[model samples]
Target: MDQTTLTRPEAETTTAAKPVILTGDRTTGPLHIGHYAGSLKNRLALQDTHTQFLLLADTQALTDNAHDIGKVRRNVLEVACDYLAVGIDPAKTTICLQSHLPALAELSMLYLNFVTVARLERNPTIKDEIRARGFGRDIPAGFLCYPAAQAADITAFKATVVPVGEDQAPLIEQCNEIARRVNAAAGREVLPEAQALIPEAGRLPGIDGRAKMSKSGGNAIPLSASEDEISRAVRAMFTDPEHLRVEQPGRVEGNVVFAYLDAFDAAKEDVAELKDHYRRGGLGDTVLKRRLEDILQALLAPIRARRAEVASDPAQVHRIISEGTQAAREVTEATKREVMDALGLFRL
Candidate 1:
């Protein structure tokens, strides 16, 4: 791939004062604490201040889940419920279904010309997913070109800020590359380059002490998990393996329990005391798990309750998604028209 394609267009050198923020997740499963720490909380904060467009990326989910449409369909509502339960006010945040925007596909097709196959293959984020999924040679074409589609998604909204985790920084870079190339080719700034806003909390470790929590890995505590489920997940969380006994000194490093505490527990002094005790050979996993469970239950009680309330009225949930998707479609249409005009391509 030519590196020049990734450079920012000379005509578009400055950013918008109040940037439009776009961030979302694949609708493969219900969201979890990882989602909360990584992007969901940021979305909540940005919704009131910036023009936010949250996407339920059903189409992207299909790249890996084409064989399981039912799972994806079920999760669309589950994820939406999780969003509402987590206080993403739909009035402030436009939550849209990715598949509803046909223009995104058109844009992706056009953007593909700007990005090379070699460049897409070199994307660290995509490579990580490919390895994680064990796709190897059997990787789907759609999965390979996901970045192009993502660029389209971001540029369709003219997103200036994309809140993401550290791992997704490359994805933002790829999106900007497409934006730069598209605008430069058009001889005008047709798309705005997006910057990644990585969260301070970064990746939350899974209950199994994995580098990152994932729904498919069965290591995630879903945002909508019941109190009992949360408790069970907490109890099973991976702690210091060498500290087999309560009296044995434990290692705090790579301990999933401690990781969760650092991420969620507000009792800084208490958590520090507990960690000290564990390090010095006193605290047990049971005690630490209990503390985590209490803190998590308290934090998630209201979210779970709200999710229950939202899930009760399926029609209302559908209505919200329908309205949001329609509104998003209009935005996508306008963006598509501009892109076509810039390319001097006739719209059918």
Candidate 2:
């Protein structure tokens, strides 16, 4: 066992060192407000205190984007920019590209022995992904095996804390199971179990009132969306479908505009009053949409400006990724050696 990796979460002790947090995004597209509300904001707040590692999961992205490798490659930088634009300081957070660490692949191969095809199929996260992709019976082997791969990512950094949304809690649970199994097999604890730290109100509904906001859904507002783009998205947002006229009382429940307002609008009393007006009638959808647009514009303006500033210098962004990747590679290499030694692999 690595005594250093076995540190417990401090109990009633302010002087204890901050917990290490590992979280990140897949580089399939630019992140959206859903990402911000879910984990990105937590990253910004935790980066200054915790040992944070953020992964641009291009290799995981390949589980789905094998045919369109270009799209995943193109958005890696865009995702990094979004991270910086939203106040994830490179100086504080180590942002690494997943494919840059061959050790992760090696670790995944070793971790696979601890997991099973039946267990991977039962993973709610993978099941959801399979359904969302409409794969039915044609699921790719890589896609099916990704949970083990993800376990490798978590264990490689010896990450004790994984910040994720509720939907991904199962992934953390799976990692814990793998950790316990591997340690038992080796007759000692080599890997530490990771705990899931879910943020408050982590999941946000899409503009279309869908269950999730994602690039494939075409209902997400990019964190770097322009004012015009934001306005258009807000205008097109889903509202009470039964309320056809301004005089018709609307339903606040499940309205996308109200959901966004509740998440981002700081004027809680005003929003509550608006909800009252909306439900009582005489409030137009246009008025509600316009209010959301104004709030969104105010919220996104600085992020957009920062993204533009960062995007203007592509080389600097690459350097940050390159440097972080190198740092992460060193860490994973050490982890790989530990695993290899425990499994009795030849030193040569």
Candidate 3:
């Protein structure tokens, strides 16, 4: 053996400050500014301190994108590219594909046994989704089982922490409920208790200032949007209708321009001044919108640069996801064995 062959404890610190956290986004379209501000950027910071698992949720996505299988398949790579572009270091965090995790699928099946339909029906998030989609009197079976699938995603890795927005708290609760039931039925606790890291950024609204941002809602400014596109989007952003006059006293408290400034601008004092000036009806919406454009451009430029670089070499991108899935596969498979034995689904 060569003298330089082994690197002993000279490698790296094994202890992480944060526990493993399971978090991800569904691939309906390109990740938007809202997603980046609300969660993606926080995830980047967590990679250094936490055992983070960033999943590209294609399976969960299929619940809605089922009709557009091509769209779902296409967005998988695009979403991975977006993640990488946004600084989700694959080296420090596991970037696995959700559909690749069979254990999660199995776990979902087992969890369904414990949850009553009434309970799933009563979930606030589910009810909101159903109403939003106008699924009155006709709900997809997969849509109903979404929370059960979510339990599998969280428990498969035995994740102790899950980063979720406030709206999704009920879903995480459902995951814990399934964990408790499955563990009690087995006469043992196998799943790690999971907690939520709700970032203070909260759920970002659309550029139109219409509640939550969504592709279907036609108001999202995607992470991969071109400079011209971003400019167009921001210029047209909904400002205080009362501030029709550039010299008119503008309200910044609920102004979409001010909200975006709060989320993206690092200079709080400057933003505060801008808000006050606008509130006094001295600052114009165009001026504020321009400042917002500058801030958003500053925020998205690097993401675009990185996305272009990774897009040029998609094979490397795919390889990273493949490696992550392989690593997650082993962990999930072992958990599935425990799950099957608990359910007496094992072979002699």
Candidate 4:
């Protein structure tokens, strides 16, 4: 916890009076287009209006990826590269490493006492994730207690705003519950409750038509995917199977291609017209896929190029992370001290 701040032009500093926002990605893998459509796009806008802190949740990634610590370690930089490539300016948003923040871990340990294992098990977000991972009776302790950990991450920064998917609303609720209990114990608001800011775009479906686009599921198109990779993913996308002929009417309700179009295509009217044509028949899946592929390639080419350029300078990336982590350390430490003092912990 060295307090190291990278020297920057005075003009680059953001106002400290803005509302604090905490949002981040688990460093399990590189971010994908789904991330862009869902949270990243909102983050880009919020950084200008709020004090944003982006955490590389390597500590949380260990809940499932403990077996492959190397993967988590390696992707910390990869995720950071993706963030920069996607236009998350470090000056506007503090991008910090989660494992580097000792205060977060300390707060998590303290907050755990305020919540019960039954309540944690009842968390919809945690339950769904457990089912999806098939953890059953073998759920990892870290994974089970992640709601508390998330509460720590949120309250440690006193983040009033957190951008997350709709499915993650319960976790925010759980975090606020912990915050309230701690405040009640302290006889004052030692930690601020957070609100979940779910994106309008919601969750993006995977190419295979899964409800979620995830790297572990092997259905995601990474932001750094090559043109050929994007094309291949689009081509393999799940569409209406019964709409075999171009002349036959098709269904767009569950079509993954249309889902992606809704998420990424800027021309809403054009997408609507395509959807109409798709539903009425005379439009082929290949045509829709081709259009989606073109849009994706155009969208990702610049990001891929930028990611490559940024990644080429590892020292600069490391410095950005180090500086951000240092700044975040100071914030978390101050909050931890406040909580400890409120709880009448021995300081000497």
Among the numbered candidates, top lDDT falls to 4
RMSD of 4: 3.2
Cα lDDT of all candidates, in order?
0.86, 0.85, 0.81, 0.89
Task: Sum up the clashes in candidate 1.
Answer: 0
User: Over the stretch 153-260, how does candidate 3's per-residue lDDT look in tens digits?
Assistant: 988878887776667889999999999998888888888778877778677778888777775678999988889999999988988877777887877655788888
Which model is ahead, 2 or 3, in terms of lDDT? 2
Give the lowest summed-lDDT range of ten residues in model 3: 2-11
Per-residue CA lDDT of candidate 1, range 53-166, in tens?
789999999999999989989999999889888988776677789988899999999999999999999999999999989998999999999999999999998888998877
Ten residues in a row with the worst lDDT in model 2?
5-14
Q: Say which candidate scores most in TM-score.
A: 4
Error of 1 at 161 (Å): 1.3
lDDT of 4 at 131: 90
Give me the runs in candidate 2 sitting further than 4 Å from their true place.
1-18
Clashes (N, CA, C under 3 Å) per candidate: 0, 0, 2, 0
lDDT of 3 at 252: 67
Winner of 3 and 4 under TM-score: 4
Candidate 4, residues 117-205: lDDT per residue as tens digits?
A: 99999999888899989997999999999889999999998999998877789999999999999999999988888999987777899
lDDT of 2 at 34: 89
Looking at model 4, residue 325 earns an lDDT score of 86
